[model samples]
Target: MQFENTLEFAQRLDKQDTLNSYRDHFLFPKVNEKQVIYFTGNSLGLQPKNAKKYVDEVMQDWEELAVEGHFYADKPWWDYHERLANPLSKIIGAKPSEITVMNTLTVNLHLLMVSFYRPKGKRYKIICEEKAFPSDQYMLQSQVRFHGYDPNDAIVEIKKRDGEHNFRIEDILDTITEVGEECALILIGGVNYYTGQVFDMKTITKAGHDIGAFVGWDLAHAAGNIKLELHDWDVDFASWCSYKYMNSGPGNASGCFIHERFHNQTEIPRFEGWWGTSRETRFLMKPQFEPMPNADAWQLSNAPILALAPYLASLELFDEVGMDALIKKRNLIVAYLEYILKEIDAQVESTFEIITPSNPKERGTQLSVFLHGEGKKLFEFLMKNGVITDWREPNVIRLAPAPFYCSFEDMFRFGQILKQGILEKNSELSS
Candidate 1:
């Protein structure tokens, strides 16, 4: 796609977008009572207008039916989570039974690790990317400690070769080869939160399987931003928060996936609770844990219907638009953002670089911009101006133009703000 500089380019792209109507569906933030250019979907997605209505339905069910709402209310709180299964499955490309709506992202990550990360005597190590989200790093470390293994010895972190922002796939594969025998699992973010690099999940899964290891992913950044085929990729399991690109709101419940092959397998031990028991027999209060034969078997508690309703509403939108179409639109918008950023970089003397991969295939909707000097100042300036993006510690600003609502015009406007912020910072430094 040729890079063009004009509002017409963005307007034309918007005109052609099938999902353009989705912008009106969200409640964008306002600056001075005017809608700001929101590009921070990597942190929190704009709330869908239907979210309130969805929540209201659940609230009404609870109010009218009381405790009976569990089994008797409309959509039934008992099976409310199940209602989300098919739609969530569609977003991540999994069999319906292979996925389940459950706990938040980090908690689900811990749960998945418990079932999938069993390490035998020699194969006790787990491989992960360096600079993974703090929550994931903590989960892995705690899991290793829980298993009576030293994390420093049992967790192998793959870092970028001297001064690089992202890890190369070959380096990851080689690390697996070098440590594959001793590795019991590979838990990686599908897209790196800091660099916006979308790892090759298929290849990573294959490498881990070759080493007799279970492989899982944290799709918090990649879930709705990228096209995924977890089951087809032979991914053993995965988990993700819906609040990011899924637009489910802050602290929304997350979803998980387990390979269909594990559906009926009793060998994998899960931390079970009553909600995971078979729905028909659950009311009987049977002592034997008769888990549902799928990812639902991993559930440890009842679904939070209030937290989940918004996600259900969002998934319906995804089901209508489809992942392929969303990703196609994302590629164009992100490419436009990248083009504009490059122009800014070329025009300015400041040391700003886009750490995200130039190829759209290797990334999702985010661009991680690395500022050589005064990163925090530049970030603050952008935020104050209402170009809302997220600032990671040390030096990166992650901008994600989520396809569901973010526009090419938003990206262009944001680029202008970023350029202006950089100029201001340079002027301050010179003075």
Candidate 2:
């Protein structure tokens, strides 16, 4: 586990990496005809080489089969979503029957709230982390407004203590207790988008349940990045976008997981559509809506095959290697990245603080760096040098080395570029 900030050490690690072959599967961004080091998978994944092949198959089916493609094409449009269930289920730790691929992340969250966020008298407030992804904040505000309650009254945010970058687990549990019977739902990001902190979902779920509240997670940053056990954790419902760590391309189809207990609850409220009806009765076009016997019951429209093709392609890779292997490489790379950052800070006398948790169990592949004094200069320097990372407001750069395609050598090259950027800033200020 010893890490050295040297090209030889990084190259040696790359030589022994079992997942090194996966780098070739993706199309890395090129700058001036050279490949750029990409560290933005937590925002948008690189395109998989097989994604085109998968899209082509669907296009060919459309050209040849037309309307009949619904029945005759390979991986028929009628069941395209089903094709992803098994692999998707394994990735998120649920049964195929409990999982369904459909709309984007926020849309699914709204639909799920229709059923899981049923607010009875006094139990109408929702609890979540402060500074959740903007989409989540907007959704929560709108959902609360739709229910005829002011957001200030209906939304309880779990804020970090003064000057802390992440929320404390005890504080979260105590907040749940403080809310008590007023809490209708407890929803949070499985991984905080900005700080790269992974919340303790198992304990949080248990706390919510004990207080008679439904629990769910926005796994936009966690779903494929970290292994989850939604069913065993007794999570009532959850939704995630596949484009992040899943490497399913931008704006690809997302996934939903509903507890098996909700499958037979025909009385549950939902925004239903034809796609959610039973396959047997779908062709009948009957007036009565007979919802499917699984998570598909939440689907509001037909599958978007084109958008889903890339997801299937990526899931094939996940299925082949499994999460256990991916997570192992992810942890190793994260450690190496942390080591490199610390070494640069120690050697260069620069201010670079890692805001991401040091514990491997509390984070996935992301490391958020808080740069002081010459933050924007260093960021622009790295970008010009082709070291692509994500930047947030006020001076934090998020570098996420995706396990499927990023290599140990990438860490080495990134470290070198970062050091150069820091030195460049110093020279600029001195001049």
Candidate 3:
């Protein structure tokens, strides 16, 4: 389908969008007394109008029931997080028994490592992509150091080929084969935060396992933005934050998936607490640990009801629209966004380098573009003009048109704003 950079064309696309009306469910911030065109949902999602209602319900329960709210409240705070497992499993493609909502993303990664990242003599190296998210970098470094190994030796980073922006599948597979028996674990971000590249998880997981290594993913950007099959992929474990595409509030609870084979393993090493024990034996307060028969076995404490509230609310939207619908819109909108960027690039003196893969299967809702001949001033111009987006170092801006709330009109408006900023800069330089 052809796309045009006109308001009428954008409006017609919007009119035909089935998910278009759902935009009203979110509350967008205003700039210049108008709702801004939001492109930072990959950073922090806009607040759902219903998020307050979810939080308020918990607040009201706490006010009236006091400590008893854990058992007597409408949803029952003790088991409130259990509500999220089913819907979240659908989004991440796992059984309800394989999913659990718990601590933040990095925290869950640390806990999961206790079971997956074991190193021994002659088999201790861990494989990961180069320039992973800073938090994951820190986590890997610390974990390796804690296990009494030098990070420089224990961490094997798969570097991108010269003049390439994304990792080639063959390079990754060859790296795994080269690492061979010494590779203890392979953990990569499912969707690269910098380039928006979606790695081939199924093939990569198989490659890791064939080399006698455990495989997992940090789904911070992939969880709600793209389709996944963690169980089918035979991923040993995975974790994701809810605040981004999931539309939960800031620093909200994270969701995790642990393959069913790992469940109820008495010999498996993990950091355990009372909350991870079977519900029947939890309140018994026995000295010996009795683990749950599912992913909840990793829980360190009782659920944070308040954080889970907003997340549960967001999953309602996911359950209603489904990931299939979101992905369908995502493909078309991202394609249109790419078209608009190329069109605008041709008109302006500046060059736009889209580092993200052009293949729809290899990207999510984000387009990380390098605006050559443009500087932070262009980003500032955009921000002041109400285009909410993310800026990386060296003149790259990440635009994520979240399908649930972002519209084609937003894309059209952003192109206009971008062209205006470029032209204005050119005029000022000539003067």
* Candidate 3 lDDT tens digits, 1-431: 98898999999999999999999999999999999999999999999989999999999999999999999999999999999999999999999999999989999999999999999988999999999999999999999999999999999999999999999999999999999999999999999999999999999999999999999999999999999999999999999999999999999999999999999899999999999998998998999999999999999899999999989999999999999999999999999999999999999998999999999999999999998889999999999999999899977999999999999999999999999999999999999
TM-score, one value per model:
0.96, 0.99, 0.99
Which regions of candidate 2 deviate over 4 angstroms? none
lDDT of 1 at 93: 88
In candidate 1, stretches whose alpha carbon ends up further than 4 angstroms from where it belongs are 426-431
- Identify the candidate with maximal lDDT: 3
Error of 3 at 109 (Å): 0.5
Residue-level lDDT of model 2, residues 1-431, one tens digit each, is 88988889999999899999989999998876779989999999999999999999999999999999999998889998999999998989999999998999999999999998888899999999998899999999999999999999999999999998888999999999999999999999999999999999999999999999999999999988998999899889999999988888888889999999989788998889999999998989999999999999999899999999999999999999999999999999999999888888886758788899888999998999998765687888898888888789899999999988888888988988888888877777789
Task: Report the lDDT tens digits of candidate 1 across residue range 1-431.
Answer: 78676778878878888888899999987876768888889889999899899999989988899999888987888888988889888888899999898989998898888888898899999999998889989999999999999999999999899988789999999999999689999999999988899999999999999989999999999999898999899999999999999999899999999989988776677899999988889889999998898788899889998998898888888888889899998998888888888888877777678899998889999998887765587888887888888888779888888888988877777777878887877787789
lDDT of each: 0.88, 0.92, 0.95
Q: Clashes per prediction?
A: 0, 0, 0
